[model samples]
Target chain A: MATDRIRDFIRTTRPDGPCLVVDLDVVRDNYRAFERALPDSRIFYAVKANPAPEVLKLLADMGSNFDTASVREIELAMEAGADATRISYGNTIKKERDIARAHALGVSLFAVDSHEEVEKIARAAPGARVFCRVLTSGEGAEWPLSRKFGCVPQMAVDVLVYAHQLGLTSYGVSFHVGSQMTNLDAWDAAIADSKYVFDKLARQGIVLEMVNMGGGFPTRYLKDVPSAEAYGQAIKGALIDHFGNQLPETIIEPGRGMVGNAGAIKAEVVLVSRKSDLGENRWVYLDIGKFGGLAETMDEAIRYPITTDRDADEMEPCIIAGPTCDSADVLYENTPYPLPISLTIGDEVLIGGTGAYTTTYASVAFNGFEPLRSYVI
Target chain B: MATDRIRDFIRTTRPDGPCLVVDLDVVRDNYRAFERALPDSRIFYAVKANPAPEVLKLLADMGSNFDTASVREIELAMEAGADATRISYGNTIKKERDIARAHALGVSLFAVDSHEEVEKIARAAPGARVFCRVLTSGEGAEWPLSRKFGCVPQMAVDVLVYAHQLGLTSYGVSFHVGSQMTNLDAWDAAIADSKYVFDKLARQGIVLEMVNMGGGFPTRYLKDVPSAEAYGQAIKGALIDHFGNQLPETIIEPGRGMVGNAGAIKAEVVLVSRKSDLGENRWVYLDIGKFGGLAETMDEAIRYPITTDRDADEMEPCIIAGPTCDSADVLYENTPYPLPISLTIGDEVLIGGTGAYTTTYASVAFNGFEPLRSYVI
Candidate 1:
């Protein structure tokens, strides 16, 4: 629905180049929807998603906590006038210096998935709250990040236990099913896996006080997906089934699911033509591409819902490419995302569901194309 | 080697964080090597490869022409003191306004892969020197970019003829085998492909003046690639075989090959530990990742040779990861890259062979981690 306004906005404004437009009204609505869906859980907005100044300020004013990944993020959150206590250093892989800097800045909460990080945190900020992350299968998520992060149940238990021994506060267990989690029950396996860690720690007389249901909330895209409310019910069912009557202080960190629907990008079709006589579709080249902002195409893993001036007309499968010198900059080659054959140069393509993981994720100066221009309304 | 100066400089300067140290001396040597190899071709350094001020300044001083992709890059090259006339707006896909602006800025050369672009260039920069790009198989390249660019023989010929009909100057034909291309003979197929376009265009009464050998020049990385001179000799042989001494002015546009080995990066290992008992390799987490920098490790497509303080001793297979919250930040998951087990927190891991695509290809503000800092020596 927001895309309608955004499309018309682009048509009327006619922004000369590719621009990421933010409707603050849509962001507020998404936040309210999430708040209504998960009333009891503390919401920590992942700062990695759309770290625009205005977006941060809006969320902070609305009293949303921040899940920061690095020292710079922690500083940015604080600079946005967010209370230091509202920020958590959420990346498990962290530098010792960043950990120390966060500690010196009065930040207490941190995420750790390994013994090495546990030791680093202990030396940097003893008695700080540290959550151990559990690895999931990362199945059914558009952007599965299973390989880079998380630990097994036994490893998570060991990491938390070791953190306790080293005089750091073992906060709880956290698990991310992966970004853009489509299968609502994807968290079921990880939630059930966390029980092992909780039971083992309780046996050791270290009572866990919290459980972090990490972010994987899917955003609306071209493909069919479960609603956010359905995601809430599925997660609620998992938490209830696992924790039962012993549910701790629950927290949820949402990155894409929060801001994705709030933003839209308008990219002018720089050129449109049939690549070759054998090729059936036209090559639709846009100003914003893999390097120029829209990097989350992730090889079509998370397809962004696209709209154009000729949407009502007949559509043809076109090879969508970014305007870059790199051949790898093709946004969707095999992904049969159809566009209007009538789509021509100077025609604007409004990319919906780009509120998160767009501008901030682009190369600073790839191909000399300017990083995506951002606007907040 | 520039890495040697960078290493000593790091040891002396003691940079506090991840830094891309570029050696201008190495760049000069690389330029001279290419100059010696392709004596007939004008060397247009692909600005997108590094685009560092000092690097551009050095190349410009050595009379290297610049292949610019965007208006910003053209401005950067000019600001770096490169003569504007020596710069070519080489990307086939460009906005009409940008095309006009480049013409306004005194750039007359452009690349075209389709009739649509030819029309745009004709409208924006009438009579500009234009080159038509021919498609290749992209075989034998460490980083293949075949899908996003290039047109087939028929389309390339059509484009050039169309440009001629539209009263614009059709400069020549261009073809890219791929980036970090191995097989020195890979250019042979494309050279043959260009002959058809050349013969067809000549039949249409359009005389071509040049043939651009688009950059795929390999840099020294983990795998051994052909020397720039070898690539030149192979290309020269192919041109002579096909053209039979009727060869026109040849042009070479080198991005990675020119600056890839001229730079190195130093990133501290944030943590080192086993991902899990099931996963065999220890996870070597660096402060930099796909976002912080080092994005060329595309599923181990272009593996950069690595070095560390404990390089001489026993080594074990390790999964290299960036210190980011995104799971996709893992550099080499299944590559079985080995590092000394003694590598621990705070150990500096020098990622050699990273000069070409590291800093210029990272997410600008991902995970709130800072962009890769660059130092020119």
Candidate 2:
């Protein structure tokens, strides 16, 4: 279906300039594959992944619950008609006002790590149901969730006990294996940790009804990356192994893995220059740079650069940079693509897999460039 | 006077939230110092460095010219009461519409890297003066300019001849030594290349009056980093060597070098935690991130962190990160400092020397965080 939608839905939103293209066909398949792999699991689409109202609306329509970390994200999900009972406000909440506001809006569940946060939440929202987030090992993973927020395995039990004393039921146990997790065992290990915590809490008269296995299933960018289906299978098997038939309502939040491959960043090649570094090696330069949004997400040195369909035959190693004066604004280095052709001034080049973070995260607002307009088909 | 004024006049301008504190007195002194070093040279405060109009107005009052790279910057400088005639639209002009706009705005001096750009300028702003940016070696510098824009010394001569035929006056030659240049020889090499280009252009009947040596003088965050005076002196001495007293309207643009040390980014420490990464280490997460600015300007890890005076006694090495969910949103790593003792739930921490690139160029309009509110005292 995704492949079919790609063929049929080449819809154009903006007449000219950068526009975010979302292929719902890809999204529908991504959701279905994730669902089939982990049947009977409650899926909470992390709203932070692609918070575009349209994207959220589609996910909500497909029976995907929302995992909101911030008050604003919860509001956006609510605006899309996501039922209050379906939202999980994971406990890494900072400001007290936000916690109270969430409670006032009838948000029931939360993620709690520290006692300070526990007391603050209890005082603000007394009847709020909560999850004690357990911090798992971040070995082999680039971004570990244990650093800033989350409770240690021992701390999770203590915090759960503390919440019970405060008349709040510990409804679930949540753990994030971290973002862009490529290692399948990382999820397995987190599940193992969650099981240990869940069993301990059960002996203390706390019945865990939910297991929030946070999403880090990386969407394949280049060749060699695992598909979303493979990631979903790994998580499903892990959940089944530990919890068996008595498995709690399962929830997984996949951010980039869900929407990364759905769109491309289209930019115009304003200037191209050739330079021989030492003896006879030449490099081409494009007009866009780090300010174009690729640099901030993928660290500027684009790991995977597939030549656009139009420019595939014109292959040459070119260094692309933003038009901004800053030098670190380089986009790609020594990219192999065809050139010496009429790919001159104002020619368009589409950088792939940029839909997720490129537009939403890093951009230059000072230059009067509006946010890349988004379109959903 | 600078220190006293900073203490008395500078305060966070936002009604309530994270903000930056800029000392106008130090900024003005830095401007005067750079101007004094290059006695005969005109100074253009590179608008791309820190474009806060309050900062611009301070520099404008202290008699600084502007090197604008975009239409927005040009408009900003004009709004700050900078004489439009004293501005030069530097290298990195990508769009043809941008060139046309620059010309229509009365920006006479423009840097042309390609024949296409030259034609665009000729058609758009026919009587424009031009500076053919020559790409020279600054091999070890953090961001080498030649890798992107500029003409080879040999190609530059041809470009000069082309501009001469097009009726656009090729007034001078400009070359950047690169940002954060530690080696004084970079300036030496660029000046030497300028001397060769100046002589070659003179023979072709072009009276080369100005030799613009672009910015990137280092600031005083690290101990051994050279002072602005040393950098200015080195450049001043080189210009005199190349053209003697005949140096035509010598111009220099010192962006980060002047402002980087004078202002600091103050963020509230929302949370602090310790995690074992090979060993146990404390992590300090802030309310701001790369999206807030200071994204990539830092070449290496910054160990120097200033907490609020109240927390001065409590110092520790903490990994500072932004509030964003993205993994790459790290501000500082393995940074050891005394954990400020008095710092509590809502105290601020000062990140020094973030004035230049942080707020000016790199910022993502995500999470609904607003443009940086600036305060100059």
Candidate 3:
């Protein structure tokens, strides 16, 4: 579906270099998949994944809730016609000014993991609805959401209790199993931790009535990532399995899975050559790289399955790189990716499943190269 | 030096969030330092290192030649008042349209490695001055130039010959020792390889007239990186050692080395907390992170020495991180960094020696956060 869309876009647009091609059709399908699997849950579509105006407008028109992280994202969501009440500020780290601004903009819901952050929110946005994050091991995540966020069960309980004391609305508990998570058990484990934090708060007579299942939903890439239905079913089962009939008003933050397959990048192969005479290793350079919208390729963490117009039975292993002069512009070096030996300069390279992070992560003209241009269909 | 400048800027400007403060006076001083050190060499200030307008204007006003990688850079250099002849299209992997557009804009110098790129140059901008890159081991460089660009010595010879055959001006051979190069031997070795390529070109009836000693000059950070004078002396010696009295017109593309020390970033600590009860390891979350602008800290490679308003004799080991929700936002995790235990949320943390790659590497509103605002004084 993406190939046909990309082909049609290329035939019409004919981009000279790298271009992001976003199809709203695939996005609508992905949203339906999530809805069908978790009919009981609310979708707080993570705005950070792909904050394209068209994508937001499509989701907002469907009355989807949004997971906003900053004041700007809150504004973007609002501008896209989503009600402020339908947006939740999910980032634990917030500036006081942003907190005040978001609250003034009517974003009453927030997420917190630290005592200092909770205090800031209380000072800046008093009476805002808040959620506590319990730490997850973040194992089996392509990009582990580890160490950067969340707290222990005791601390999570304390954060909620402190929120209640500060006259803030203690709403729920949240956790990110991590981005591109494959193992459903990781969510099972995180839910178990969230239950501990939730039960502890319930005992203290604080009935936090929301359960935020943070974003980590995977989209199809190089591997057979679990379908959105599979993830939604697993999460729903865990919520019931862990909490029984006491399941709180549920929210699922879907970023990557919601939009990853909906977009693709059409990049031109700038150069292709054999690096060493001794080894059979071939190096293929594209106009897009780490600083040029492919920052997700750091250490080959997020592999965007690549294909070219040129096909050959005799494929050669190659390392993919960006056009920047920096040595760190390499996209893939460790992975043994085989490309058609017939691939040559000026050939089109289509990187699939790049809709979510690719355009958003582009560097601001690292080498005088322009930011990635996206064409939404 | 940067602390005082930043404090003065913030006092006067009153920036609400992360600010990139670049002292043009310091940039001028750094430029003068390079000019004084490498008096015999032309300084093609690599624009990628810091594409700030003020930085470009200051360098251009001082009559410094620029090393531009793309058509946009060429326009920026020209807009900043640098003569077209002074700006070389140094990126080897360029689209033909960019080449044609840059040529129409009066740029003549271009760098090429592969045959296809050479052909594109020939077709788009015939008679453009060209340089071929010979592969370097990229040893003794912090970021290791590795296998991204450049070709073998044999390919270099063939490329130069091919450029000449295509009626393009085969000017010389170029090679990068890699970014932030510490070992002088890498340059010496690269110079030797350049000589091999140069000599091979000369024997083929083409007298190449330029040698570009590509950027890699180190800047002072956590450790005592060699001074600009030290690098200039070693490079001067190596150029002579390899080319002797017959040395061609030389160019040094000093990017980070020229502008790295001239800028500093004022970031606020969003949160600081211990990860778990068992481990005493603290994490200091800053408003800026890898996506926000400090992308050079790939795997703890480029370390920026940090200082805070709050200082104490009592310190704790900590991992620095950016405010983004991505787990990959962690900046430093490998090395032992001791931070003041008294440091808390809302404290201003100044990251020093960030002038070069900071602003240029920031993602374009990643997570709905604004680009790093730069104020050149």
The alpha-carbon RMSD values of the candidates against the true structure, listed in the order shown, are 1.7, 3.7, 2.0
Alpha-carbon local distance difference test for all models? 0.85, 0.68, 0.85
Backbone atom clashes (below 3 Å) for every candidate: 0, 28, 0
Candidate 1 per-residue lDDT, tens place, A1-377, comes to: 35566666776887777889888888787788778888888899898997888888998999899999888888888888898899999988887878899999999999998998999999988889999988888888788875667788898888899999999888899988888888877888888888888899999988888888889887888777687788779878988999898877888998888889889888788888776888677788888888878888767777788887699999888888888888888888886679987787888778888989998888888887767888887
Please give, for residues A285-333, the per-residue lDDT of candidate 3 as tens digits. 8889888788787778887888776664578778888888777788878
Docking class of 2: acceptable
Q: Which residue pairs in candidate 3 collide?
A: none
- Going through the candidates in order, their DockQ values are 0.79, 0.36, 0.66
Once superposed on the true structure, which residue ranges of model 3 sit more than 4 Å away at CA? A1-3, A276-279, A312-314, B1-3
Docking class of 3: medium
Global Cα lDDT for candidate 1? 0.85
TM-score for chain A of every candidate model? 0.96, 0.87, 0.97
So what's the TM-score on candidate 3?
A: 0.96
Residue A137, candidate 2: C-alpha displacement in angstroms: 5.5
